[model samples]
Target: AQSVTQLDSQVPVFEEAPVELRCNYSSSVSVYLFWYVQYPNQGLQLLLKYLSGSTLVKGINGFEAEFNKSQTSFHLRKPSVHISDTAEYFCAVHEGSQGNLIFGKGTKLSVKP
Candidate 1:
């Protein structure tokens, strides 16, 4: 089985400040990893994904994350964030054949201006 855990339930940062969102996962088999962002009253959008490649993966809006196999972690980072980046972030895994996602409770990012 595969499961994900997000360390922080919320992170409030000022505009243009650096931020890091912690995430960890456990799986007996191989799995696809993904991070999605959901703004208020809007659907989720793909932030970034780690299929199989270099440990470092970059996504839209200047966000990036590194996959650490030893720690079983995939932590998101941004050098600087904006007020518009405020949203709910979910760390997910797709280790099943049906392609259903197992999402973490969620990390709320509150970007203050």
Candidate 2:
């Protein structure tokens, strides 16, 4: 069984500042990595994903992540964040094509102006 670990439960950043949310996973086989964000009172939305090919993948809202197979880590980063960026970010991995996904505890990104 695979599992994801989110290093931090919450991250605080000032508006227009860069931020990184750490994520790590453990699996015996290859898996698909993804980052999803959920704003207050909203459902989760895909932020980025690493299905295959490139290790570096980009996603909406200027968010990007690197898939480091060696380390089994996929960390999400935003060069500059806005107050509107405040949300809960989740790191998830899907094994095989079962459509069953294992998600991290989630990291709440607090962007203060």
Which candidate leads the pack in lDDT? 2
lDDT (tens digit, per residue) of candidate 1 on 1-113: 78999999999999999999999999866668899999999999999999998999999999999999889999999999999999999999986678899999899999998
Q: Global CA lDDT of candidate 1, please? A: 0.93
Model 2, 52-107: lDDT tens per residue? 99999999999999999999999999999999999999999996667988999999
Full-model lDDT for every candidate: 0.93, 0.95
TM-score attained by model 2: 0.97
Pairs clashing within candidate 1: none
What ranges in model 2 sit over 4 Å off?
A: none
TM-score of each: 0.97, 0.97
